[model samples]
Target: MTTNAPRHIISLLMENEAGALSRVAGLFSARGYNIESLTVAATEDPTLSRMTIVTSGSEAVIEQIIKQLNKLIDVVKVLDLNDGKFIERELMLVKVKATGAFREEMKRMCDIFRGRIIDVADGSFTIELTGSGTKLDAFIESLDKAAILETVRTGASGIGRGDRILKV
Candidate 1:
């Protein structure tokens, strides 16, 4: 397997309105840069939105991406979480087969991972989990591949660890 590239978590504050997100996405697409994951939502300030994007590249490529983002009209500020201490978390909802012998094992695994069974049917269980991306990946790896029916993930959301803050 190929070794993973260095990943960077980029957080930005931008105007909260139609087309803003599209513009940011377009910038990456135009440059042939791949965005591993992206999440955006309106912040407490109605006029602003917080977006978190995960990508991997060399130092020079990352710097260029940041510079280009800063030039966008809707972008107010950009912060690279890797530059300092930051806390990151992602949310995932996974639905898996939970019948026969698999049911008990699935429940046990969820308990071990601190995941909550949010929904249950006769043959399936939907679990809600929140943690670092690595933790989430481990949870998936622990399960039987064929057992996983569906999964929804909210990309990594991050913030500086302490008094450091990103604001316009």
Candidate 2:
């Protein structure tokens, strides 16, 4: 990761309808920008959706991205979490080989990371963990690479800290 190129967590409140997500994604694709991770779901207001996008770029580039996002018709509100104190988290479900001795080791690893063993089968265990991206990455790194069978992650979801709230 390049420290000079800052990573930004952008949150958006938009119309919950078809093409809304496409337009948001298209804006980045058309400009040749890459989205590191994205997660979207309907908000408390069924008519609105909340989207969290993680991207990295220079200061000017991040400003441009925010500007462009604000111009979209379906976008009701846009917030750059990095602009203020915020809390960010991600959830990951990983399946690892757990046969024989590996089972005991994997269980110990999950306990050490405070991860929950959500599922178990004859040869594997599925664990659920939630935390900052770095902590999640570290947990994965701590395990043997070959022991990992599959993984799924919910991209970063963030909200402003303290009394700051983004609302239309």
Q: List the residue pairs that clash in candidate 1.
A: none
Q: Predicted candidate 1: what Cα RMSD to the true structure? A: 1.8
TM-scores across all candidates? 0.96, 0.96
The positional error of residue 26 in candidate 1, measured at the CA in angstroms, is: 0.3
Give per-residue CA lDDT, model 2, range 36-144, as digits (tens). 9999999888999999999998888888899999999999999999999999999999999999999999999999999999999999999999998988999999999
Score each candidate by Cα lDDT. 0.94, 0.93
Model 2, runs deviating above 4 Å: 1-4
Question: Lowest-lDDT window of 10 residues in candidate 1?
Answer: 1-10
Error in Å for residue 145 of model 1: 0.7
RMSD of 2: 1.6
TM-score of 1: 0.96
